[model samples]
Target chain A: MASPPRLRAENLRSALAGPFDVSVAAGRCLAVTGASGSGKSLFLRMIADLDPNTGEVWLDGRARSAFTAPAWRRAVAYAAAEPGWWTETVADHFPDLPAARAMAARLGLKEALLDGPVLRLSTGEKQRLALARTLLRASPVLLLDEPTGPLDEDSVGRAEALMRERLAGGAAIVMVTHDPAQAARIGDEHLVMRAGKLEPP
Target chain B: MNPIVLTPRDLAVAAILLLVDAALSVALRLGLTRALGIAAVRMVLQLLFIGYVLQRVFAIASPWLTLGVLLLMTAVAAREVAARPERKLRRYGNEAVGLIAVGFATAIASILALTTALRPAPWYDARYAIPLAGIVLGNVLNAASLALDHLLGGVVREKPAIEAQLCLGATIGQAMAPLRRAAVRRGMLPVINQMSAAGLVTLPGIMTGQILAGLDPIQAVKYQILLMFLLSGGSGLSAVAIVYLAGHRLTDARHRLRLDRLA
Candidate 1:
């Protein structure tokens, strides 16, 4: 098993990185629920090393700062709430066709969206598509910020189920959400963040 | 040498006016003033400094110095624009080099062949090389800066729609394609606009300078066309190079996000 929460952050903080002071375990999905603007997204960003903070974070017993930026980012994959569309076409978005198509269908999207212009997709469709992209990397630690926050009830359920099915392999999952039901259903552990601090539950 | 005609009172008034403009530029950005005072000051200061530096450089006439200056300018601009403290800056420095080089080389090569080669002047002549190279590099720098800014900002702006793709195993390049397009478009837009408006809308700086130097209007027009074409090519090439180079820099050893550097 990956050793107990080894990533270190002395006073990690940012617009979206953190003021976080906790470590997370591998293979455990830690669900974060908190008030709006309570730094939950920032906390996850801190873990991903995507923002600047005073503290140190360790991955696999190595200091995050010690690793080059690209290495550190690659180790932890973060999926934001709205996700970006870097390309016009779906095939362009997903270089690897089979995986993209399979993940798309798994997330209840029509594989037809792959050939279609991404600009035409609805918000829920985008959310589903973003998840498909994340699944492509298959990172060991998945940091999700409201992965389904923009989706409808049906899409939310579909995404939640997809997350449950896809994330395994001793990978750590840190997710931020407002829905308590999602917290209960998706998380193996729960933490409520407010005013830049995480309350262990 | 340029003639000096201003009196002390005029100089003082001019200085005061410049200072006032400086104050207004930053104030405008901050809503503290109504004009771009700081921007005007910054532009004047930067241009004046470059003017003095180039005057000395032209006097000394060293080719290596020319190349060194170009490299230093490219590095500094890259770092300046890449200043997202939370985002990594080092890798982009090298990538910026690649972008600037494409612009620099292409500009030099085109001009050397078209004008200098046709006339066969000394390759190191500052009168020709300095202004021409500056024009090329300046255009490239602008494009590269825009491209990088758009790429990083676009990612932040549209991250969620991207993250789901990450869950499904999308490569970083795959994830970033949409952003790359946005960035390139943003970078190259100015060049496109300039190309579209070449003659009728504005009197281009090069052609105007040539006319002042006693070149005929027809000759000046040719020079302007050559320069505009150089700038357009430089901008386009630099934009493409910066994107590709940055794409390479963005990934880690395992081809994952450069999370640590993002901070």
Candidate 2:
């Protein structure tokens, strides 16, 4: 079988990440679980190369330093608990509307929401839409920080289905969450983020 | 014309603002006190120097000298705007070069062409061109610098979110969409406010100067209206362009937000 696309983090540390060392394989959904202030999200951040860390990382056997930041990120998708919305219209968030719209619709968003003001979007709507935008282009590696959080039963189910589809497309997923039941359902392997450690599932 | 003098109350208010600004600045970083100091002191020094320089220049009436000073001022203002944000702090000289080349040259060319070429009167006129450019560039510079600081600071703060966008097939420019838009909008705000406030509530510096210079009230109002529009438009473009340029500091050739190279 093909070697699973992997990201090896050799001791990543930051104000948020602390000090972490782990290698995450692709086609494998890795869930990082921890309590509040446990650095779960920070671990995902350093692995994703979103924040500054002292540790080195390798993606797909190539050093992260080998690829420019934009190039690396293009191949890796990350979502935060809070995403910045910079424009009045939702369509402004994505370069192409059809892609964003298609994924958004799958997550139960209407086409009218595209042209409507983004300021009007609810919190759950914001999270779902951000996830949709990510799912549309869903990169080879995905680092998600609470992509689905505190949602009702129905929305969580839809999100879980979407996550599976992304996995089917062969993306390495690194996710941070506290919910064990949710983690068990979506993650192929689980990792706990506590005291700056990526404990294997 | 009676020399316009600040009343005792006006002086008191100025003292209060200066004192309050200094107190607040001690607690705050990013040179609010320095700006206040510049506002209070440099405005005086600049005006003093300009009066003498203009007196001599107005007598000599050399188009080249007036032209030189105007270019120098614009270039200097642009450098200040671009230098306010720290990229590498060590590599700031390169940033200054870029800001001067892009921001200064662009603003200078437009103002010169518009004021001199199109509305050609007694060319190399200090009375008109010098003050006009100063107001435009000075206001816009802070806006530009603030925008850069905000965007970069936000990038570091929101790196994961931005990186996430790129990982999901977003280009560097694509990833920075929110930031770029925010930077430009935030930069453009003051100019927009001045445009909104030009005539309704307060007399802007330009109109006041024009009136003090013995221009008729009606003619001064007309000039102020036109000047406000031009000033707004020019500063808005300069501020936004400087912000984009600031973003270019981090992104590589393909346009990803690269913080590694920056200090």
Candidate 3:
């Protein structure tokens, strides 16, 4: 039998989202598309255990409860739609400066941008940098909430390419996106969320 | 050199000072006259009541009675601490946390001072213990309340940032470290300022009273220095304890930022 999927959610339910059952294997991506308030973000948040939710999530066949919350979150990382930066400078947020610089370069961000204060960055720039911050973790499962929401077409393409590289390295991805074309391009399986339930498009 | 005793007639003379403040409120339409009158009456009544109680307690000098008064004072201070914050924990969580911190810090500081520094005969002597505990409780109450206010407000304002840190695989302690530090510092600020300004900008109340009671200036300064040390130490302990306790309440075993816990 094939090995268990890298990330599996079985009957995950939260107040605002999910009774969601989904699976994404290693080297594949599950792209979720939904309207503005269809609970796409909340679904991913439940999978990451960022919000209070019921039911089970398994990583590499082990239950979410088996690992500590921090460890589970480390392996199953969630990048928020508008991620927060607590520090004044961008460099303070990243543990590995050179790796962040490389990731920034790949995401079409300038090296100088990494050294400046985060407040000065545009929304698009902040979004990409946040993605870079999450990507550095090399988590086995990546949950991206509208990762390319504010990026221009060219930048979006670059961000997608970077995610594809993570997939190539056997990291499973569950992404929430608004762009059907982008989802079609990068997603191994596409699901539409409506009223907290996922359905095939 | 005995202190001059002020009779009721002399006290009435001192009460005349409020006329200037009342006149200003009336003329400026600050609308504080009612509040001012009520507050002045309350202060006089409360102080007189406390003086009577302390006089009786000193005569009895019973340890149980002394402890009872201290606990009563702490409960009142804890309630004050709980009510000062704009945002509060649901139920009386803030009050419970404040009581624990203030009670613990006050006990430790007063016990240490009485045993090692003052060495009052029969250490729990009402005269020494009541006044010292009162002073420590007053400072600890301020610190605990201020720290709680800062933590509750900070948690709400910085929710996103805190949640972001948790998302990045941070434990609750790690996520809350900066906020805890900021809140404790905010709480300790008043005592810090008072310590730095003591004898330079202003004579602290206790020392001023000691001097007025004809204690030697140098001896009064020594007592003031000791009291300042106790106040600062108690404030720091209470601030740290209250912030950590409140922060713990704001999060959970799963390290999630439980914003629902706050009201």
Candidate DockQ values, in order, are 0.17, 0.24, 0.75
The alpha-carbon lDDT assigned to residue A115 of candidate 3 equals: 93
Estimate the lDDT of model 2. Answer: 0.71
Query: lDDT tens string, model 3, B1-263?
Result: 89888899988888888988999999999999999999999999999999999999999888899999999999998998899999889888989998999999999999999999999899999999999999999999999999999999998888878878888899988998998999999999999999999989999999999999999999999999999999999999999999988888888899998888887
- Give candidate 3's error at residue B24 in angstroms: 3.7
TM-score of chain B of 2: 0.73
**Candidate 1: stretches off by over 4 Å:** A6-11, A15-18, A152-154, A166-168, B1-263
Q: Report chain B TM per candidate.
A: 0.70, 0.73, 0.95
lDDT of 2 at A133: 74
Name every residue pair that clashes in candidate 3: none
Provide the interface RMSD of candidate 2 in angstroms, 1 decimal place: 3.9
- Candidate 2's C-alpha runs over 4 A off are A1-6, A10-21, A54-59, A62-68, A89-117, B1-164, B177-237, B249-263
- DockQ, 0 to 1 scale, candidate 1: 0.17
lDDT of 2 by residue, B1-263 (tens): 55466576876677887788798888786468777877888876787787898788767767788788877876777577656775432367335633553456346644664565446466446666666666666766766666766776777876766665565656777778777778778877877887777778788877788787777879888877666666656656665666566677676664456676456
- Backbone clashes in each candidate structure, one number apiece? 70, 5, 0
In model 2, the clashing pairs are A73-B166, A73-B167, A76-B167, A78-B164, B172-B255
Considering TM-score, where higher is better, how would the candidates rank from best to worst? Answer: 3, 2, 1
